[model samples]
Target: MARPRTQLLSRDIILDAALELINTQHDFTILGIGRHLGVNPSSLYHHLSGGRDEIINALRERFYKNIDLASLQPGHSPWQSRIESWVRSYREAVAQYPAAIPILIGRIVDDVPTLAIYETLAAILVEAGVPGSQHVGIIAMLDALVFGSAIDAGSPEPLWNTTEDRQPHLHQAVASSSTPDRVASGLAMGIEASVAYIERLAVGPSDGAN
Candidate 1:
Protein backbone atom coordinates (compact mmCIF):
# COMPACT_ATOMS: atom_id res chain seq x y z
CA MET A 1 0.00 0.00 0.00
CA ALA A 2 1.34 3.44 -0.98
CA ARG A 3 1.46 6.00 1.86
CA PRO A 4 0.12 9.50 1.36
CA ARG A 5 2.68 12.30 1.29
CA THR A 6 2.36 14.87 4.04
CA GLN A 7 2.68 18.61 3.53
CA LEU A 8 5.77 20.36 4.79
CA LEU A 9 5.66 23.81 6.39
CA SER A 10 8.38 26.03 7.77
CA ARG A 11 8.86 29.37 9.47
CA ASP A 12 9.79 30.97 6.19
CA ILE A 13 6.51 29.91 4.66
CA ILE A 14 4.54 31.48 7.48
CA LEU A 15 6.56 34.67 7.35
CA ASP A 16 6.19 35.05 3.59
CA ALA A 17 2.52 34.30 3.76
CA ALA A 18 1.99 36.69 6.65
CA LEU A 19 3.79 39.46 4.80
CA GLU A 20 1.62 38.82 1.77
CA LEU A 21 -1.47 39.05 3.92
CA ILE A 22 -0.26 42.26 5.49
CA ASN A 23 0.39 43.68 2.05
CA THR A 24 -3.00 42.74 0.67
CA GLN A 25 -5.58 42.06 3.33
CA HIS A 26 -4.06 44.31 5.99
CA ASP A 27 -6.11 42.35 8.48
CA PHE A 28 -5.44 38.63 8.51
CA THR A 29 -6.44 36.16 11.15
CA ILE A 30 -4.93 32.82 12.17
CA LEU A 31 -7.69 30.96 10.40
CA GLY A 32 -7.11 33.10 7.33
CA ILE A 33 -3.45 32.14 7.31
CA GLY A 34 -4.36 28.53 7.71
CA ARG A 35 -6.72 28.80 4.76
CA HIS A 36 -4.07 30.53 2.72
CA LEU A 37 -1.53 27.78 3.45
CA GLY A 38 -3.97 24.88 3.55
CA VAL A 39 -2.70 23.93 6.98
CA ASN A 40 -4.40 23.66 10.31
CA PRO A 41 -4.18 26.85 12.36
CA SER A 42 -2.77 24.73 15.19
CA SER A 43 0.11 23.75 12.95
CA LEU A 44 1.19 27.35 12.77
CA TYR A 45 1.52 27.32 16.53
CA HIS A 46 4.12 24.59 16.26
CA HIS A 47 6.53 27.06 14.63
CA LEU A 48 5.37 30.46 15.85
CA SER A 49 4.85 31.46 19.41
CA GLY A 50 3.22 34.53 21.02
CA GLY A 51 0.66 34.72 18.23
CA ARG A 52 0.31 38.06 16.42
CA ASP A 53 3.04 39.69 18.45
CA GLU A 54 5.50 37.00 17.45
CA ILE A 55 4.55 37.44 13.83
CA ILE A 56 5.15 41.16 14.19
CA ASN A 57 8.60 40.49 15.63
CA ALA A 58 9.34 38.18 12.72
CA LEU A 59 8.22 40.83 10.28
CA ARG A 60 10.50 43.41 11.87
CA GLU A 61 13.35 40.93 11.82
CA ARG A 62 12.82 40.30 8.13
CA PHE A 63 12.75 44.01 7.45
CA TYR A 64 15.89 44.81 9.45
CA LYS A 65 17.75 41.58 8.70
CA ASN A 66 20.23 43.27 6.40
CA ILE A 67 21.04 46.37 8.46
CA ASP A 68 24.83 46.47 8.41
CA LEU A 69 26.49 48.23 11.29
CA ALA A 70 29.97 48.44 9.81
CA SER A 71 29.43 51.60 7.84
CA LEU A 72 27.81 53.24 10.83
CA GLN A 73 30.51 52.24 13.26
CA PRO A 74 32.66 54.99 14.69
CA GLY A 75 35.84 54.63 12.66
CA HIS A 76 34.24 53.98 9.28
CA SER A 77 32.39 57.27 8.93
CA PRO A 78 32.03 60.56 10.72
CA TRP A 79 29.38 60.49 13.44
CA GLN A 80 27.06 62.69 11.40
CA SER A 81 27.48 60.53 8.32
CA ARG A 82 26.86 57.45 10.37
CA ILE A 83 23.64 58.83 11.76
CA GLU A 84 22.47 59.89 8.29
CA SER A 85 23.40 56.53 6.77
CA TRP A 86 21.68 54.61 9.54
CA VAL A 87 18.55 56.73 9.18
CA ARG A 88 18.63 56.18 5.42
CA SER A 89 18.93 52.43 5.78
CA TYR A 90 16.16 52.32 8.36
CA ARG A 91 13.84 54.37 6.16
CA GLU A 92 14.59 52.19 3.15
CA ALA A 93 13.74 49.04 5.06
CA VAL A 94 10.67 50.49 6.71
CA ALA A 95 9.29 52.00 3.50
CA GLN A 96 8.58 48.53 2.12
CA TYR A 97 5.79 47.65 4.54
CA PRO A 98 3.87 50.72 5.46
CA ALA A 99 0.79 48.87 6.67
CA ALA A 100 2.63 47.03 9.45
CA ILE A 101 4.55 50.00 10.77
CA PRO A 102 2.20 50.27 13.70
CA ILE A 103 2.67 46.66 14.68
CA LEU A 104 6.42 47.13 14.56
CA ILE A 105 6.26 50.26 16.67
CA GLY A 106 3.89 48.74 19.20
CA ARG A 107 5.93 45.63 19.85
CA ILE A 108 9.04 45.51 21.95
CA VAL A 109 12.09 44.88 19.81
CA ASP A 110 13.58 41.55 20.88
CA ASP A 111 15.08 40.53 17.57
CA VAL A 112 18.84 39.91 17.65
CA PRO A 113 19.68 42.04 14.63
CA THR A 114 17.48 44.84 15.91
CA LEU A 115 19.21 44.68 19.27
CA ALA A 116 22.56 44.83 17.53
CA ILE A 117 21.47 47.97 15.74
CA TYR A 118 20.75 49.65 19.07
CA GLU A 119 24.04 48.45 20.50
CA THR A 120 26.01 49.78 17.57
CA LEU A 121 24.17 53.08 17.59
CA ALA A 122 24.88 53.46 21.28
CA ALA A 123 28.53 52.71 20.79
CA ILE A 124 28.75 55.20 17.97
CA LEU A 125 27.04 57.86 20.04
CA VAL A 126 29.35 57.18 22.92
CA GLU A 127 32.28 57.58 20.58
CA ALA A 128 30.76 60.87 19.51
CA GLY A 129 30.90 61.94 23.18
CA VAL A 130 27.21 61.63 23.94
CA PRO A 131 26.75 60.88 27.61
CA GLY A 132 24.63 58.02 28.86
CA SER A 133 22.18 60.42 30.51
CA GLN A 134 21.09 61.84 27.19
CA HIS A 135 21.16 58.60 25.16
CA VAL A 136 17.52 57.68 25.69
CA GLY A 137 16.12 61.04 24.66
CA ILE A 138 18.46 61.39 21.70
CA ILE A 139 17.73 57.87 20.54
CA ALA A 140 14.02 58.57 20.83
CA MET A 141 14.37 61.65 18.69
CA LEU A 142 16.36 59.74 16.10
CA ASP A 143 13.79 56.97 16.08
CA ALA A 144 10.95 59.43 15.59
CA LEU A 145 12.79 60.96 12.66
CA VAL A 146 13.52 57.60 11.07
CA PHE A 147 10.13 56.02 11.59
CA GLY A 148 8.25 59.18 10.68
CA SER A 149 10.29 59.49 7.53
CA ALA A 150 9.52 55.90 6.66
CA ILE A 151 5.81 56.55 6.96
CA ASP A 152 6.06 59.78 5.03
CA ALA A 153 7.78 58.12 2.09
CA GLY A 154 4.47 56.52 1.11
CA SER A 155 2.53 59.78 1.20
CA PRO A 156 0.30 60.46 -1.80
CA GLU A 157 1.70 62.68 -4.53
CA PRO A 158 0.91 66.39 -4.10
CA LEU A 159 -0.12 65.55 -0.56
CA TRP A 160 -1.47 69.01 0.17
CA ASN A 161 -3.91 70.94 -2.01
CA THR A 162 -4.55 74.45 -0.77
CA THR A 163 -6.60 76.80 -2.94
CA GLU A 164 -4.91 80.12 -3.79
CA ASP A 165 -8.12 81.95 -3.01
CA ARG A 166 -8.31 80.54 0.49
CA GLN A 167 -4.66 80.59 1.46
CA PRO A 168 -2.47 82.35 -1.09
CA HIS A 169 0.82 82.05 0.80
CA LEU A 170 0.27 78.38 1.54
CA HIS A 171 -0.73 77.73 -2.05
CA GLN A 172 2.30 79.57 -3.37
CA ALA A 173 4.64 77.65 -1.11
CA VAL A 174 3.11 74.35 -2.07
CA ALA A 175 3.37 75.19 -5.77
CA SER A 176 6.95 76.37 -5.46
CA SER A 177 8.03 73.09 -3.80
CA SER A 178 5.70 70.73 -5.67
CA THR A 179 7.43 67.63 -6.92
CA PRO A 180 6.93 63.88 -7.18
CA ASP A 181 9.26 63.05 -4.31
CA ARG A 182 8.91 65.92 -1.91
CA VAL A 183 8.35 63.44 0.86
CA ALA A 184 11.72 61.94 0.17
CA SER A 185 13.29 65.38 0.23
CA GLY A 186 11.61 66.06 3.56
CA LEU A 187 12.99 62.84 4.96
CA ALA A 188 16.49 63.82 3.93
CA MET A 189 16.11 67.20 5.56
CA GLY A 190 14.88 65.63 8.81
CA ILE A 191 17.85 63.31 8.99
CA GLU A 192 20.26 66.16 8.27
CA ALA A 193 18.66 68.30 10.94
CA SER A 194 18.87 65.52 13.50
CA VAL A 195 22.53 65.01 12.66
CA ALA A 196 23.20 68.73 12.96
CA TYR A 197 21.62 68.75 16.41
CA ILE A 198 23.85 65.86 17.39
CA GLU A 199 26.84 67.87 16.23
CA ARG A 200 25.82 70.75 18.44
CA LEU A 201 25.42 68.43 21.41
CA ALA A 202 28.89 66.99 20.78
CA VAL A 203 30.37 70.47 21.18
CA GLY A 204 29.47 71.26 24.79
CA PRO A 205 31.13 68.66 26.95
CA SER A 206 32.52 65.13 27.17
CA ASP A 207 30.00 63.82 29.65
CA GLY A 208 30.67 60.33 28.30
CA ALA A 209 34.03 60.53 30.16
CA ASN A 210 35.77 59.35 26.98
Candidate 2:
Protein backbone atom coordinates (compact mmCIF):
# COMPACT_ATOMS: atom_id res chain seq x y z
CA MET A 1 0.00 0.00 0.00
CA ALA A 2 1.21 3.55 -0.73
CA ARG A 3 2.13 5.67 2.29
CA PRO A 4 -0.30 8.49 3.21
CA ARG A 5 0.84 11.97 2.22
CA THR A 6 1.07 14.34 5.18
CA GLN A 7 -0.22 17.93 5.07
CA LEU A 8 2.63 20.43 5.00
CA LEU A 9 2.56 23.19 7.60
CA SER A 10 5.02 26.07 7.65
CA ARG A 11 5.23 29.63 8.90
CA ASP A 12 4.02 30.92 5.54
CA ILE A 13 1.12 28.52 5.49
CA ILE A 14 0.01 29.41 8.98
CA LEU A 15 0.38 33.10 8.44
CA ASP A 16 -1.53 32.91 5.18
CA ALA A 17 -4.40 31.15 6.92
CA ALA A 18 -4.42 33.69 9.74
CA LEU A 19 -4.38 36.58 7.29
CA GLU A 20 -7.26 35.09 5.35
CA LEU A 21 -9.29 34.86 8.55
CA ILE A 22 -8.36 38.42 9.44
CA ASN A 23 -9.36 39.61 5.99
CA THR A 24 -12.74 37.94 6.19
CA GLN A 25 -13.55 38.06 9.91
CA HIS A 26 -11.19 40.83 11.11
CA ASP A 27 -9.84 38.42 13.73
CA PHE A 28 -8.31 34.96 13.98
CA THR A 29 -7.91 32.15 16.47
CA ILE A 30 -5.49 29.26 16.55
CA LEU A 31 -8.23 26.68 16.15
CA GLY A 32 -9.82 28.72 13.40
CA ILE A 33 -6.53 28.88 11.54
CA GLY A 34 -6.05 25.18 11.96
CA ARG A 35 -9.52 24.52 10.64
CA HIS A 36 -8.87 26.82 7.71
CA LEU A 37 -5.69 24.91 6.96
CA GLY A 38 -7.17 21.43 7.60
CA VAL A 39 -4.77 20.73 10.42
CA ASN A 40 -5.29 20.11 14.10
CA PRO A 41 -4.86 23.21 16.23
CA SER A 42 -2.07 21.62 18.27
CA SER A 43 -0.29 20.79 15.04
CA LEU A 44 0.26 24.49 14.53
CA TYR A 45 2.35 24.61 17.71
CA HIS A 46 5.01 22.55 15.96
CA HIS A 47 5.51 25.49 13.61
CA LEU A 48 4.58 28.64 15.51
CA SER A 49 6.09 28.40 18.95
CA GLY A 50 4.58 31.72 20.02
CA GLY A 51 1.25 30.74 18.42
CA ARG A 52 -1.21 33.62 17.91
CA ASP A 53 1.20 36.37 18.91
CA GLU A 54 3.78 34.95 16.56
CA ILE A 55 1.23 34.83 13.78
CA ILE A 56 0.21 38.43 14.38
CA ASN A 57 3.83 39.58 14.35
CA ALA A 58 4.48 37.56 11.23
CA LEU A 59 1.49 39.16 9.51
CA ARG A 60 2.69 42.57 10.61
CA GLU A 61 6.10 41.86 9.11
CA ARG A 62 4.50 40.71 5.88
CA PHE A 63 2.54 43.93 5.42
CA TYR A 64 5.34 46.22 6.57
CA LYS A 65 7.63 44.61 4.00
CA ASN A 66 5.26 45.82 1.29
CA ILE A 67 6.45 49.39 1.94
CA ASP A 68 9.09 50.84 -0.43
CA LEU A 69 11.89 51.34 2.06
CA ALA A 70 14.37 52.32 -0.63
CA SER A 71 12.66 55.68 -1.02
CA LEU A 72 13.31 56.51 2.63
CA GLN A 73 17.05 55.88 2.42
CA PRO A 74 19.41 58.79 3.03
CA GLY A 75 19.62 60.58 -0.31
CA HIS A 76 20.58 63.82 -1.96
CA SER A 77 16.93 64.88 -2.15
CA PRO A 78 15.56 67.25 0.45
CA TRP A 79 14.26 65.62 3.65
CA GLN A 80 10.76 66.76 2.74
CA SER A 81 10.90 64.81 -0.50
CA ARG A 82 12.12 61.66 1.23
CA ILE A 83 9.43 61.92 3.92
CA GLU A 84 6.76 62.41 1.27
CA SER A 85 7.91 59.33 -0.60
CA TRP A 86 7.94 57.27 2.57
CA VAL A 87 4.36 58.21 3.61
CA ARG A 88 2.99 57.81 0.07
CA SER A 89 4.50 54.35 -0.15
CA TYR A 90 3.22 53.55 3.32
CA ARG A 91 -0.34 54.56 2.46
CA GLU A 92 -0.24 52.49 -0.71
CA ALA A 93 0.97 49.44 1.17
CA VAL A 94 -1.41 49.58 4.13
CA ALA A 95 -4.35 50.46 1.90
CA GLN A 96 -3.97 47.07 0.28
CA TYR A 97 -5.00 45.34 3.52
CA PRO A 98 -7.46 47.67 5.17
CA ALA A 99 -9.18 44.81 6.91
CA ALA A 100 -5.98 43.89 8.71
CA ILE A 101 -5.31 47.38 10.03
CA PRO A 102 -7.14 47.05 13.34
CA ILE A 103 -5.64 43.71 14.22
CA LEU A 104 -2.18 44.80 13.15
CA ILE A 105 -2.33 48.03 15.11
CA GLY A 106 -3.87 46.46 18.22
CA ARG A 107 -0.66 44.63 18.94
CA ILE A 108 2.62 46.16 20.03
CA VAL A 109 5.06 45.81 17.16
CA ASP A 110 8.02 43.75 18.32
CA ASP A 111 8.90 42.48 14.89
CA VAL A 112 12.45 43.27 13.73
CA PRO A 113 11.53 44.46 10.23
CA THR A 114 8.69 46.62 11.53
CA LEU A 115 10.91 48.12 14.22
CA ALA A 116 13.58 48.73 11.58
CA ILE A 117 11.12 50.80 9.58
CA TYR A 118 10.56 53.05 12.60
CA GLU A 119 14.32 53.20 13.14
CA THR A 120 14.76 54.39 9.58
CA LEU A 121 12.11 57.07 10.12
CA ALA A 122 13.87 58.22 13.30
CA ALA A 123 17.15 58.42 11.45
CA ILE A 124 15.52 60.54 8.74
CA LEU A 125 14.05 62.89 11.33
CA VAL A 126 17.40 63.16 13.08
CA GLU A 127 19.10 64.04 9.81
CA ALA A 128 16.43 66.67 9.13
CA GLY A 129 17.32 68.41 12.44
CA VAL A 130 13.97 67.62 14.04
CA PRO A 131 14.18 67.74 17.84
CA GLY A 132 14.76 64.35 19.47
CA SER A 133 11.99 65.15 21.94
CA GLN A 134 9.50 65.43 19.11
CA HIS A 135 10.56 62.38 17.10
CA VAL A 136 8.11 59.98 18.79
CA GLY A 137 5.19 62.40 18.55
CA ILE A 138 5.94 63.19 14.91
CA ILE A 139 6.24 59.54 14.00
CA ALA A 140 3.01 58.79 15.86
CA MET A 141 1.21 61.51 13.93
CA LEU A 142 2.39 60.12 10.63
CA ASP A 143 1.27 56.67 11.66
CA ALA A 144 -2.16 58.00 12.58
CA LEU A 145 -2.47 59.65 9.18
CA VAL A 146 -1.31 56.58 7.31
CA PHE A 147 -3.55 54.14 9.19
CA GLY A 148 -6.58 56.44 9.08
CA SER A 149 -6.07 57.07 5.38
CA ALA A 150 -5.70 53.38 4.72
CA ILE A 151 -9.12 52.72 6.27
CA ASP A 152 -10.68 55.69 4.56
CA ALA A 153 -9.42 54.57 1.18
CA GLY A 154 -11.62 51.50 1.45
CA SER A 155 -14.73 53.47 2.40
CA PRO A 156 -17.51 54.18 -0.13
CA GLU A 157 -17.51 57.49 -1.94
CA PRO A 158 -19.64 60.54 -1.06
CA LEU A 159 -17.94 60.52 2.30
CA TRP A 160 -20.16 63.29 3.54
CA ASN A 161 -23.94 63.28 3.29
CA THR A 162 -24.96 66.77 4.33
CA THR A 163 -28.06 68.29 2.72
CA GLU A 164 -27.74 71.71 1.05
CA ASP A 165 -30.74 72.97 3.02
CA ARG A 166 -29.17 72.08 6.37
CA GLN A 167 -25.56 72.86 5.62
CA PRO A 168 -25.24 74.73 2.33
CA HIS A 169 -21.58 75.64 2.70
CA LEU A 170 -20.45 72.16 3.67
CA HIS A 171 -22.52 70.60 0.89
CA GLN A 172 -21.11 73.06 -1.62
CA ALA A 173 -17.58 72.25 -0.56
CA VAL A 174 -18.07 68.54 -1.07
CA ALA A 175 -19.86 69.06 -4.36
CA SER A 176 -17.25 71.44 -5.75
CA SER A 177 -14.37 69.07 -5.12
CA SER A 178 -13.49 67.20 -8.35
CA THR A 179 -10.42 65.19 -7.50
CA PRO A 180 -10.12 61.99 -9.53
CA ASP A 181 -8.61 60.04 -6.64
CA ARG A 182 -10.02 61.48 -3.46
CA VAL A 183 -8.10 59.18 -1.16
CA ALA A 184 -4.80 59.71 -2.89
CA SER A 185 -5.44 63.44 -3.08
CA GLY A 186 -6.27 63.63 0.59
CA LEU A 187 -3.26 61.51 1.49
CA ALA A 188 -0.98 63.74 -0.57
CA MET A 189 -2.41 66.83 1.07
CA GLY A 190 -1.99 65.36 4.52
CA ILE A 191 1.57 64.29 3.82
CA GLU A 192 2.39 67.72 2.46
CA ALA A 193 0.93 69.37 5.54
CA SER A 194 2.89 67.06 7.83
CA VAL A 195 6.16 67.65 6.02
CA ALA A 196 5.54 71.38 6.19
CA TYR A 197 5.05 71.13 9.94
CA ILE A 198 8.25 69.12 10.28
CA GLU A 199 10.10 71.71 8.23
CA ARG A 200 8.96 74.42 10.60
CA LEU A 201 10.12 72.36 13.57
CA ALA A 202 13.54 71.80 11.99
CA VAL A 203 13.86 75.55 11.43
CA GLY A 204 12.88 76.30 15.06
CA PRO A 205 11.03 79.35 16.56
CA SER A 206 12.17 81.66 13.74
CA ASP A 207 14.45 83.90 15.90
CA GLY A 208 11.60 85.39 18.04
CA ALA A 209 8.93 85.64 15.37
CA ASN A 210 5.47 84.65 16.65
Candidate 3:
Protein backbone atom coordinates (compact mmCIF):
# COMPACT_ATOMS: atom_id res chain seq x y z
CA MET A 1 0.00 0.00 0.00
CA ALA A 2 1.19 3.55 -0.77
CA ARG A 3 1.91 5.79 2.20
CA PRO A 4 -0.62 8.61 2.65
CA ARG A 5 0.47 12.22 2.73
CA THR A 6 0.08 13.50 6.29
CA GLN A 7 2.26 16.58 6.44
CA LEU A 8 0.48 19.71 5.31
CA LEU A 9 2.59 21.95 3.09
CA SER A 10 3.73 25.23 4.61
CA ARG A 11 5.67 28.08 3.01
CA ASP A 12 8.82 26.91 4.74
CA ILE A 13 8.23 23.37 3.59
CA ILE A 14 7.71 24.51 0.05
CA LEU A 15 10.87 26.59 0.14
CA ASP A 16 12.83 23.70 1.62
CA ALA A 17 11.63 21.36 -1.08
CA ALA A 18 12.39 23.92 -3.74
CA LEU A 19 15.93 24.31 -2.45
CA GLU A 20 16.36 20.56 -2.49
CA LEU A 21 15.08 20.40 -6.03
CA ILE A 22 17.52 23.11 -7.04
CA ASN A 23 20.40 21.22 -5.48
CA THR A 24 19.49 17.93 -7.10
CA GLN A 25 18.51 19.18 -10.54
CA HIS A 26 20.43 22.46 -10.78
CA ASP A 27 17.27 23.96 -12.24
CA PHE A 28 15.36 26.78 -10.57
CA THR A 29 12.08 26.78 -12.48
CA ILE A 30 8.88 26.75 -10.43
CA LEU A 31 7.35 23.93 -12.43
CA GLY A 32 10.43 21.76 -12.04
CA ILE A 33 10.51 22.48 -8.33
CA GLY A 34 6.83 21.55 -8.03
CA ARG A 35 7.44 18.17 -9.69
CA HIS A 36 10.25 17.45 -7.28
CA LEU A 37 7.99 18.02 -4.28
CA GLY A 38 5.05 16.08 -5.71
CA VAL A 39 2.87 19.15 -5.80
CA ASN A 40 1.10 20.99 -8.62
CA PRO A 41 3.15 23.83 -10.10
CA SER A 42 0.41 26.35 -9.35
CA SER A 43 0.39 25.39 -5.69
CA LEU A 44 3.78 26.96 -5.23
CA TYR A 45 2.30 30.38 -5.88
CA HIS A 46 0.14 30.11 -2.80
CA HIS A 47 3.17 29.77 -0.55
CA LEU A 48 5.85 31.39 -2.66
CA SER A 49 4.48 34.05 -4.98
CA GLY A 50 5.43 32.59 -8.36
CA GLY A 51 7.99 35.28 -9.03
CA ARG A 52 11.73 35.19 -9.52
CA ASP A 53 12.29 37.92 -6.92
CA GLU A 54 10.36 35.99 -4.27
CA ILE A 55 12.18 32.72 -4.93
CA ILE A 56 15.50 34.52 -5.10
CA ASN A 57 14.88 36.33 -1.82
CA ALA A 58 13.89 33.13 -0.06
CA LEU A 59 17.00 31.36 -1.28
CA ARG A 60 19.29 34.27 -0.36
CA GLU A 61 17.80 34.41 3.13
CA ARG A 62 18.44 30.72 3.58
CA PHE A 63 21.98 31.08 2.28
CA TYR A 64 22.75 33.90 4.71
CA LYS A 65 21.27 32.00 7.63
CA ASN A 66 23.44 28.98 6.93
CA ILE A 67 26.67 30.96 6.79
CA ASP A 68 28.98 31.33 9.81
CA LEU A 69 28.95 35.12 9.98
CA ALA A 70 31.43 34.82 12.83
CA SER A 71 34.03 34.17 10.18
CA LEU A 72 34.39 37.94 10.35
CA GLN A 73 35.77 37.66 13.89
CA PRO A 74 38.36 40.15 15.08
CA GLY A 75 41.92 39.17 14.28
CA HIS A 76 45.28 40.72 15.17
CA SER A 77 46.61 40.75 11.61
CA PRO A 78 45.75 43.25 8.89
CA TRP A 79 42.08 43.86 8.02
CA GLN A 80 42.71 42.53 4.49
CA SER A 81 43.06 38.96 5.82
CA ARG A 82 39.82 39.31 7.76
CA ILE A 83 38.07 40.56 4.63
CA GLU A 84 39.49 37.69 2.57
CA SER A 85 38.33 35.22 5.24
CA TRP A 86 34.82 36.60 5.04
CA VAL A 87 34.83 36.34 1.24
CA ARG A 88 36.11 32.77 1.43
CA SER A 89 33.36 31.83 3.85
CA TYR A 90 30.77 33.47 1.61
CA ARG A 91 32.12 31.66 -1.45
CA GLU A 92 32.08 28.30 0.34
CA ALA A 93 28.50 28.78 1.48
CA VAL A 94 27.18 29.83 -1.91
CA ALA A 95 29.22 27.22 -3.79
CA GLN A 96 26.99 24.57 -2.24
CA TYR A 97 24.31 25.65 -4.72
CA PRO A 98 25.88 27.31 -7.73
CA ALA A 99 22.48 27.55 -9.34
CA ALA A 100 21.67 30.02 -6.57
CA ILE A 101 23.99 32.69 -7.99
CA PRO A 102 21.40 34.65 -9.96
CA ILE A 103 19.09 34.51 -6.96
CA LEU A 104 21.77 35.96 -4.71
CA ILE A 105 22.66 38.91 -6.93
CA GLY A 106 19.03 39.76 -7.69
CA ARG A 107 17.86 41.12 -4.37
CA ILE A 108 20.64 42.50 -2.24
CA VAL A 109 19.06 43.50 1.08
CA ASP A 110 20.55 46.37 3.05
CA ASP A 111 18.55 46.03 6.23
CA VAL A 112 19.85 46.49 9.76
CA PRO A 113 21.83 43.28 10.17
CA THR A 114 23.23 43.48 6.68
CA LEU A 115 24.08 47.10 7.14
CA ALA A 116 25.73 46.35 10.45
CA ILE A 117 28.07 43.88 8.83
CA TYR A 118 28.80 46.23 5.97
CA GLU A 119 29.43 49.14 8.28
CA THR A 120 31.64 47.03 10.49
CA LEU A 121 33.77 46.02 7.51
CA ALA A 122 33.78 49.53 6.15
CA ALA A 123 34.99 50.78 9.51
CA ILE A 124 37.76 48.21 9.57
CA LEU A 125 38.86 49.28 6.11
CA VAL A 126 38.72 52.88 7.24
CA GLU A 127 40.79 52.09 10.31
CA ALA A 128 43.21 50.37 8.01
CA GLY A 129 43.02 53.75 6.26
CA VAL A 130 41.02 52.68 3.19
CA PRO A 131 39.48 55.62 1.39
CA GLY A 132 35.78 56.28 1.92
CA SER A 133 34.93 56.59 -1.76
CA GLN A 134 36.35 53.17 -2.58
CA HIS A 135 34.59 51.24 0.18
CA VAL A 136 31.60 50.25 -1.92
CA GLY A 137 33.83 49.38 -4.86
CA ILE A 138 36.01 47.23 -2.63
CA ILE A 139 33.01 45.31 -1.37
CA ALA A 140 31.72 44.92 -4.91
CA MET A 141 35.05 43.41 -5.97
CA LEU A 142 34.85 40.83 -3.20
CA ASP A 143 31.28 40.04 -4.17
CA ALA A 144 32.28 39.49 -7.80
CA LEU A 145 35.11 37.14 -6.86
CA VAL A 146 32.87 35.11 -4.57
CA PHE A 147 30.07 34.81 -7.11
CA GLY A 148 32.32 34.31 -10.15
CA SER A 149 34.39 31.66 -8.40
CA ALA A 150 31.22 29.84 -7.31
CA ILE A 151 29.98 29.77 -10.89
CA ASP A 152 33.32 28.58 -12.23
CA ALA A 153 33.51 25.88 -9.58
CA GLY A 154 30.13 24.54 -10.65
CA SER A 155 31.04 24.46 -14.36
CA PRO A 156 31.91 21.13 -15.99
CA GLU A 157 35.54 20.16 -16.52
CA PRO A 158 35.25 19.99 -20.29
CA LEU A 159 34.26 23.65 -20.40
CA TRP A 160 37.64 24.51 -18.87
CA ASN A 161 39.71 22.23 -21.11
CA THR A 162 41.03 23.69 -24.34
CA THR A 163 43.08 22.54 -27.35
CA GLU A 164 46.73 23.32 -26.67
CA ASP A 165 47.64 23.99 -30.32
CA ARG A 166 44.64 26.24 -30.87
CA GLN A 167 44.89 28.23 -27.66
CA PRO A 168 48.29 27.99 -26.00
CA HIS A 169 47.71 30.54 -23.21
CA LEU A 170 44.24 29.20 -22.49
CA HIS A 171 45.42 25.58 -22.64
CA GLN A 172 48.38 26.23 -20.39
CA ALA A 173 46.18 28.04 -17.88
CA VAL A 174 43.55 25.32 -17.80
CA ALA A 175 46.02 22.43 -17.61
CA SER A 176 44.22 19.68 -15.65
CA SER A 177 47.08 18.63 -13.39
CA SER A 178 47.00 21.87 -11.40
CA THR A 179 43.45 23.12 -12.04
CA PRO A 180 42.34 23.03 -8.41
CA ASP A 181 45.46 24.77 -7.19
CA ARG A 182 45.11 27.34 -9.97
CA VAL A 183 41.55 28.18 -8.98
CA ALA A 184 42.69 28.76 -5.41
CA SER A 185 45.52 30.91 -6.63
CA GLY A 186 43.13 32.90 -8.82
CA LEU A 187 40.74 33.52 -5.96
CA ALA A 188 43.59 34.64 -3.72
CA MET A 189 44.81 36.94 -6.46
CA GLY A 190 41.39 38.47 -6.89
CA ILE A 191 41.03 39.10 -3.17
CA GLU A 192 44.55 40.46 -2.85
CA ALA A 193 44.09 42.84 -5.76
CA SER A 194 40.90 44.26 -4.29
CA VAL A 195 42.41 44.60 -0.82
CA ALA A 196 45.59 46.12 -2.15
CA TYR A 197 43.64 48.63 -4.23
CA ILE A 198 41.66 49.68 -1.16
CA GLU A 199 44.80 49.94 0.95
CA ARG A 200 46.39 52.14 -1.67
CA LEU A 201 43.33 54.35 -1.79
CA ALA A 202 43.79 54.76 1.98
CA VAL A 203 47.10 56.54 1.46
CA GLY A 204 46.24 60.23 1.18
CA PRO A 205 45.02 62.60 3.93
CA SER A 206 41.39 62.31 2.77
CA ASP A 207 41.29 58.67 3.96
CA GLY A 208 38.61 58.83 6.69
CA ALA A 209 36.69 61.93 5.56
CA ASN A 210 33.49 60.00 5.17
| Top lDDT prediction, candidate number | 2
- Model 2, range 53-105, lDDT digits (tens) per residue? 88888787777787767667765466777787777777777888899899878
lDDT (C-alpha, whole model) for all candidates: 0.78, 0.83, 0.70
TM-score of each: 0.87, 0.88, 0.73
Tens-place lDDT per residue, model 3, 1-210, is: 977687666777777776776676754677776777778888788877745557766666666675555655445445667777777877887887887677566666644444555666776676677667877888777778988988878767556557889999888866745555555777888888877776677764333322
lDDT of 1 by residue, 59-129 (tens): 77889887887778645756767777888888788888887787678778887777887888787777887
Model 1, CA-based lDDT: 0.78
The positional error of residue 148 in candidate 3, measured at the CA in angstroms, is 0.5
Backbone atom clashes (below 3 Å) for every candidate: 0, 0, 0
Rank list by TM-score: 2, 1, 3
Roughly what TM-score does model 2 have, to 2 decimal places? 0.88
Q: Which stretches of candidate 2 lie over 4 Å from their true place?
A: 1-8, 203-210
Arrange candidates by lDDT, highest first: which order?
2, 1, 3
| Model 1 weakest lDDT span, ten residues long | 201-210
lDDT of 2: 0.83
Candidate 2 — worst ten consecutive residues by lDDT sum? 201-210
